[model samples]
Target chain A: GQQVQQSPASLVLQEGENAELQCNFSSTATQLQWFYQSPGGSLVSLLSNPSGTKHTGRLTSTTVTKERRSSLHISSSQTTDSGTYLCAPFNVGDNSKLIWGLGTSLVVNP
Target chain B: EAAVTQSPRNKVTVTGGNVTLSCRQTNSHNYMYWYRQDTGHGLRLIHYSYGAGNLQIGDVPDGYKATRTTQEDFFLLLELASPSQTSLYFCASSGTGVEQYFGPGTRLTVL
Candidate 1:
């Protein structure tokens, strides 16, 4: 079974500050994806990075597949960015086996 | 827009009761999955299907059954529920990619 562990189970940040979250997975996979759960509890996929670094807006995802590690960086955070960030190692080759991390909760203070 | 929708956003049942959670994905994705989220457990997969009529067991499948009757419809069933089963359930859909979209989620409470 694959195990995914996220660092800094919870965090608090000042608005406009930068935040970093880490995710480590136990097994190799085709891609490492990130999901965000809002304070209102809606879950949405944020990014899917297989390797190297990818950025979307103020968020960036870096994945080292060989190292089984991925990181998410949120720059210039805002109050609306407060939420839980989750990671999962997914294997498209295998149907029914995506391992999810416990997630890192982020709170952006005003 | 592509979306995944779940029925009975909240459910309350008693021990030994029968319950069904329904999911429908308009994304037309081939893969649909069921997961339960708890305080410490994070998210545990209950079952998943690659397509219509195809079912696969996941990490936590005990006391749960799932069916995929159509490409857009997937269902999770609990013939006899327990208090331990009280948790937030999520339904997700994805195509051949690793990226998945989740539903609004269902909160089930068994007394």
Candidate 2:
């Protein structure tokens, strides 16, 4: 079975500060995605970066498939950014079934 | 936008009871999935289907059954449910890509 581990089980940051979350997988993954779950209970798809780097707004995602690792970076974090971030890896030939990380809880203070 | 809708956002059932969680997608995706989220285990895959009238067992399929009857509907069934089955369930849909869109989620509690 494949395992996905996220670093810093939890983190607290001051408003306007930067945050970085790491995800490492035990096996090779053909695709990787980052998702944000808000306190409002909505899970938003952030990025689908299986390899290389991608940026959307103040958020950035970098995935190195060869190393079986991915990272999500938040710049100038805000109070609304407080939530849980999950990383999921899917095997290409497996019908997109995902192996998810427990998630990194991020709290931003005003 | 891709949308996945789940019915009965919250549910409470007793042991040995039968429960069904319904999911619908308006995006017309070919792939649909059901996953359970727990405290420390994250989200575990229960079942998935590539199209209507098809079902595939996922990583954790014991005590769970799934059915996909139409392009827009998928259901998860729990027969003779137990307390251990209590958890938050999510339904997701995606096309050929691996980027999945999740539903609002259903919180199920088996007493």
Which pairs of residues clash in candidate 2, taking residues 3 or more apart in a chain or in different chains? Answer: none
- Taking all chains together, each candidate's TM-score versus the true structure is 0.97, 0.97
How much does candidate 1 score in TM-score? Answer: 0.97
For model 2 the local lDDT of residue A87 reads 96
Model 2 lDDT tens row, B1-111: 888999889999999999999999999899999999888888889999999998988989999999999999999999999999999999999896478889999999999
lDDT of 1 by residue, B1-111 (tens): 779999999999999999999999999899999999998999898999999999999889999999999999999999999999999999999886468889999999999
Off by over 4 Å in 2: none
For each candidate, give the TM-score of chain B. Answer: 0.98, 0.98
lDDT scores in order: 0.92, 0.92
Name model 1 segments beyond 4 Å from true.
Answer: A92-96
Model 2 chain B TM at 0.98
DockQ of each: 0.75, 0.74
Interface RMSD of 2: 1.4
A16-98: candidate 2 lDDT, tens digit per residue: 99999999999989889899988766787898998999999999999999999999999999999999999989897655688
Give the Å shift of residue A66 in candidate 2: 1.6
